[model samples]
Structure formats: C-alpha cells, structure tokens
Target: MSFKITIQPSGHTFPAAADDSILEGALAHGLLLPYSCRNGACGVCKGRILAGNVDYGEYQDTTLTHAEKAAGMALFCCAKPLSDLVIESHEVSRAQEIPVKMLPCRVEKMQKVADDVMVLWLKLPANERLQFLAGQYIDILQKDDKPRSFSLANAPHDDGLLELHVRHIPGGTFTEQVFTRMRERDILRIKGPLGTFFLREDNDRPIIFVASGTGFAPVKAIIEHALKIGFQREMHFYWGVRKVSDLYMLDKIGEWEKLGIRFTPVVSDEAWHGRTGFVHDAVLQDFSDLSAYAVYACGAPVMVQAAHRDFSAQRGLQDDAFFSDMFTFAPKQ
Candidate 1:
C-alpha cells in the first residue's frame, strides 16, 4: 500500500504509504520538504497535484479553496495518495532558499527533564512553517527588550513539531514565567533559522562534537541530521555536565551510539562513574592532533572559546574546521 511520489524540479522520488501524507513519506526517506504544521489546516505544504489520485484529508475550507483545488494544488500534509503521484513542490536544499519568518506559536507541551532544564514543544500557526537548518535557533519575541534565544533541539528530518531546550535562568523574566506560569497553548512570537551554525557536509574529516549544559541542544540537532543523511565521517560526541543528573536524553544518545557515533560523557561536579573534568578537556586529552577533524562545539561562552582556542592551537585543527554558536557572536573559523 505504498505509492511513489515524485517531486518536481529536483525530480526526487520517495514512497508514501496509503496512510502517509506526502510530506511525511518524503521526510522519512531523507527528502527535505518545506512544511510548518503537519496538520492540513496550514497550506505551507500546498503543492500542485500534477498527476495523482488523493484523498484530501479534512482541512479548513479557506485553507484549500475550490479555485485552488481546481488549479491542482493540494495540502501535502493532509493528502494521502490513492495511487502513484507526481507532485510539483519546491524542496529545501540550501539555507538561503529558506525564508526567515516571524510567526506566532503555542507551547504545545513542556517537560522538566532536569532541575533547571525545560523542554518545550512549539506549534506554529496553521498556515506557516519556519524552514531552518538543523543547528540553528529561534528568538522568542518578548514584550519588551531583546528576544530570548533558544536552540532548536529537533533535527530537520523530524520537524513536525519544533522542539527547544530552555535552561531556567533564575530571576529571568521569560524563563521564570516558563517554569512558573506558562501553560500549554500559551502564545509566543518567534523569528529564526537565525544562526550560521550547521553541518559542513562538503568535508570528509572526522567529526568531534562538544556540548555542555543545554548547549547539547544544537549539537543534538546536528548529530541527528548527520545520522539521517547517513553520516559519512567518524563522529565522536562529548557531553559535559555539572553532574550526572543534569544529563537527559540518554536513550537518544544510546541510539546514536548504536549507529557508530562514539559517546563520551564528562562530569565536572560531584563524583561520577565516567570521565571527569571539563568537556573540552576530555576532547583535548583524547585528541592531541585534530588537524583533519571538524569540531562542532556549543555551550557556555567559556567552553566554546576554550575548545576553539585549544583544539586549534594544540591539536593543529584548521581555523576553518571549528564551528560554534551562542548569540551568533562570531563566524565559524
């Protein structure tokens, strides 16, 4: 009960099961299609049904007007193929092709994984989708002052819902509210795909990812994306936390380990059963010469700075081989 869906221009094809939306099928096969909300209520997945029979699932009338339907446009998020289909849709292949958008989102769900870590699932409006690279972040537009930035913890291949990891900044307005007052469905504004932090797929060097605290957010996205695209280089992930309890998402990390990515956990505070000391120190101790390695490090400003400085100075890593993200202070070098 699977149908082949062909995307135009790019001419890429993937299988869509009888119960699968064209968008879901494409993403499951590593095809990047532009979509915001998986629900048919949004028209972001709208594309011309060039040649196919489909059961267009329920969606608001205005979302797919009769005129548009006659014109062959269907919501890929809601349409299930009745037969093999040919579709005319733009595929997202480059960051520059994605338009930065300012959209309102609702807090769909929240989980307090650690004492100070909160995981938020955001739902965009029905008609909007924010196309972003795997390791980018979003700015939550607040009432006044600057927008609070948070890394998108979810990989692009799993973009049905936007996931963010927020560390509770004590006494901080937004975080305090997020921990104490924000409820499911609470509204917020966001602008993103904002930073240049992402995978450089052009190279063939071994990859070393260093993450600390919530900085694990972006690193998680990059690693997940790499896995989805079939990682072509050796990958070593080093996650450093103050205590073992601060480490969450071990199950996902375990899956990555099974996929051949090495995992190293470093604890800086309290006694631990694993490697001890700063996360970067763990990398330094292991990789004395990293001239051919690509490093993607994210975390506290000090850790990012230290990993960049030492890995290049001592390990012989090329200046262009390091990439880091935090407020987009500087370019990758």
Candidate 2:
C-alpha cells in the first residue's frame, strides 16, 4: 500500500509505498532529502519521524541507537513507511548539503579505452556508498603524495562501481602508475562526491554541453543522469579532442543520439571528415545567439576561459547561465 509522506517546515508531501525506503520515495519525487550510504551504514540520513509508524529496515545497530530510536529518530535510508508519515528533515537543495566521505575502495576493473585514457571502476566496501550528485568528482588519496582528483563518470543511479577516466600525462606520478602498474584488486582511499559542476535542474532552459578531453567524464555523468530522469529540456552535446583517436565511447554516444540528444564530436590538431577547430567555436558557428541556453563547459583551462568569454560577450549568453569546470593538468617535473 502507498502512504503519504510529509516533510516538516517545508510542508512538502509525496507518496511512499510500503516497500520504498523513505529516501527512495523522496528522491523519486525530486525532493532531495539528505542521504549517504543508502545501505544504512552511515547515520547521515537519520531524522525524526515526527508522526506515524515505520518498518525501520535493516541497519547497523550502532548507527541507530535505541536512545535515538526512542526519541523518534530513524535512518531514512533503511526506513520504510507503515502509514502516513510526517518527517522532520532538511532537503538537499545545494551541493554542500551532501556529506563528504573518506572510504576505502578496491579497483574492481580497469580498461584502456584510448591510447592515453584508462577507465577505472572502483568498488566501495560493503554497506558503504558515497552519496553525490551527478558531475561531482572524488579525490584519490595517496600515502606520500597529494590526492589526485577524478570526475565520477557514472550517474548516481548506476553507481554500483564508481567510474573514473584517468588520462596519462607525461611526467605525472599517479597517472604514470595507473598506466604502468595499477591493477585490479589494488586498494585505494578516496574522498568525495565533491564539486559544484552539476546540472541546475530548477529551470527548463535548453542545455549546451561543451567538453574537452577527459572532461567528457563529468559531462557523461550529468547527461546520463538527465536521461535517466527523463529530463525534457533540449540538450546539445559537443565533445572536443586533440585527434580522432582521442574520442572514445562512440557506441554509447550513438545510443544517446537515438534518444533525441544531439551529439557533435570535434577533433582539433589532426582531423578526419567531421567538425574541426576549437569546440566552443563550433557552438558559435551553429547558433547565432545563445541568450536562452544554459552552457556547461569543462576540460582545459584555456578552452573554458575562451568559452566563458566568447559565449557571454559575443553570443549573448547570460553570465550566470554558464557553468564550467576547468581541468588543470599536473605540472611536468
């Protein structure tokens, strides 16, 4: 049976079926309730059940102590409704609302998709999952060196294995190890679900995604999430690379095109028989005005800067309408 669930203060209400976790129901309604480790290992999703009964599904005893339970608290991640409910919980409307986590993960698999790009799949420990929005990144921790940040390529819905596309850089320490020595079952520490470079879902504005090199990682995440949620906004995706060989995931791109999302692959430096030159300029060439589009740009710092300057000043895109994440490379040592 389905029951009505109401949020205190906000007074927002949504329907929750008997089998759906409180978090699941809220998310299905586009109501962002704070959550982490949706498996109930983390207490980040704990909140007061101000009214009505709940199943309070399986969870670690320590995460939801008897004292807290008696005080009307329940772990929303594991709790399922028994009747209509009113819950006292804050919504996660901003990136900062999600908790950051540091956890150990195993390299479950690795595939070299291109000459310089290696896709790594990381598996979190049992009962632990990192909660994050699409397009966020994680920092791979190192014992004797600084952490290396990589964008999560998989959307939140398909987060069983954290996907990361790591590009090899000449003289780079970590990437050199990844390309030369890292193997499956290798243990690694990661901290995140970080960054603000995510989709702004509040509006119905058409989106123009500009990605370069491995910047395609985060853009892939956002686009996948958008598609999963059946976002009806018009989307145009342009991916740029140094050469034709630098472009990977053509099969997946082909699938997305069939679903109505426009895809343009731009190759700079060396070209075949497709779009060439700077990726941003291709957008300029296609659209006479971008005043109504929301542009999300990622990749090299120079390309991001150029897109930001030209799109707003030349193409009439509003300054606030453009969002970007500049991929900075490690310095050669």
Candidate 3:
C-alpha cells in the first residue's frame, strides 16, 4: 500500500509506495532531500519522524543509535513508512550541503555514445555512495603524475553509480586507455564532487544552457537535476558539435523536449536539417535579450569564452548569469 509523507518546515508532501524508502519516494517526486550513503551507514539522512510509524529498515548500529531511535529518529534512506508520516527534515539547497569524497570504483559499464565519447558508469563498493551536487567534475586519480578530470554526466537524485563522459583525445594516455583498453571491473581512484558549476536553484530566471562537444557532460548532469526537481522555468539548451555524429545523447535531449525544454542542436562542420553554425550564435539569433536569463555553458574553452563574452556584451546577459566550465587537456603522463 502507498502512504503519504510530509516534510516539516517546507511542508512538502509526497506519496511513498510500500517498497520505497522515504528517500526514494521523495526523490522520485522531485524533492531534493538531504542524503548521502543512501545505505543507512551515513547519518546524514537521519531525521525525526515527528508523527507516524516506519519500518526503519537495515542500518548500522553506530549510525542510528538506540538513543536516537528511541527519540523517534530514523534514517530516511532505509526507512519505509508504516503509515502516513510527518518528518522533520530539510532539502539540500547548496553544494556544501554534501561532503566531497575520495573513493575507488569499478568500471561497471561503458558505452561509445559518440564517435569520440565514451560514457562510463563507475560502481562504488556495496553500501558506498558519493554525494555530489549536479554539474561537478571528478578527478580520476591514476598512477600518472597528474590526474585526469571529467564532468559527471548523471543527476544527483539517481546517484547509485557515478557516470562520466570521456572524450578520446589522441596522445592522451588515460583517455587512450579508456577508448582502447579500459575493461569492465577495472578499479579507478577518484577525488571529487569538485567544481562550483552546479545549477543555481534559488534563482527564478529562465535558463539557457550551452554545451560544445564533450562539454555536454556537466550540462547533462545539471539539466537532468533541474528537470527532476520539476523546475518550470523556461529552458533553452543549445548543444553544438562539429558534425551530426558528434551529437550523442539525442535520446535524452529529445525526452527533455517532451517536457517543454527548448532544444536546439547546432552542427558546425556539416550541413544538417536542424539548426546550424556556432551554438552560441543560435542562442543570439533566438533570444534578443539575455539579461533576464541565466546561461550555463560548458565544453571547449573557445566556446565557453565566446558564450561568456557575447552573451554578456551582445545579448545583455549579466556576467554573473553566465556560468561556465572549460575542458582543458590533462597533463600528460
């Protein structure tokens, strides 16, 4: 049977199915509740069950002590509602709300999403999860002198496994391995949830997201997160690639279009049926004034710089409204 749950203070409420933990139900309904390990090991998800009964599922002894439990506290990540519940908890509204972590993960899956892009899924050890704000990049720690960094391509609410989009750069050893020899079950060390390019949720302005080549990685993360939270702000996403082949993940973008997200795929190197020329130019051609909008751009430095410069100077967008992350080549091994 399904039960209802109400979060205190915010007064946000959602229905929870019998098999779903409180956290799962909340996330599925676009609620960004504060959580970490998802498994009950981390007390970050602990909160008072102000009213109603719950099946506090499996948890670590030290995490939810008897005293805390006796006081009606429960780990939302593992707790299943036994009846309608009123919970005292708050949403995570900032990047600092979650802790960064250094973890080793096994390459669980990989897909050649584009001619030069490999989408990888990294699985943490059992009961382990990495909490991160959307749009953050992670440094892949290798034995090489310098580590490589890649933006996470998955949304925070769906963080069972970490996802990254890696571009195959010629002469880049790590990327070369990823394209050529990296195998499933390979272990990789990562330091992350780094960078400050996440979506600014507090603002109510419409959003324009620009992505070039592989820079779409972080933008994908941010867009998915924004969509999951049920944000209704006007969203215009422009992803520019050299050729049609370079534009991967169209399926995901197409899904967004169904939800009213304006999607413009700009192809620079080839003639296409869709919009053409520089991605930023497409934005300029469409929107005469951007001052009222927030623009997040990622990918090649050239594109990010161009978007930052033009969107502010020509389109009247505020400098602060233009957020960007430039993809730079990692130091060679």
Top lDDT model = 2
Candidate 1 pairs with clashing backbones: 36-129, 42-126, 319-333
Model 2 TM-score (2 dp):
0.90
Predicted candidate 3 versus true structure: per-residue lDDT over 286-332, tens digit per residue: 98999899999998889989888888889899877878888989532
Stretches of model 2 off by over 4 angstroms after superposition: 1-6, 11-18, 28-30, 50-53, 65-71, 82-86, 331-333
When 1 and 3 are scored with lDDT, the better candidate is 3
Model 1 clashes, total count:
3
> Global lDDT of each model?
0.86, 0.90, 0.88
Q: How close to the true structure is residue 291 of candidate 2, measured as C-alpha lDDT?
A: 96
Give candidate 3 regions above 4 Å deviation: 331-333
TM-score of 3: 0.93
In model 3, the Cα lDDT at residue 36 comes to 68
Q: What is the per-residue lDDT of model 2 for residues 196-303, given as tens digits with 9 covering 90 to 100? A: 999898877899999999999999998998887678899999999999999999999999999988999999999589999999999999999999999999999999
Q: List the RMSD of every prediction in angstroms.
A: 3.5, 2.8, 2.2
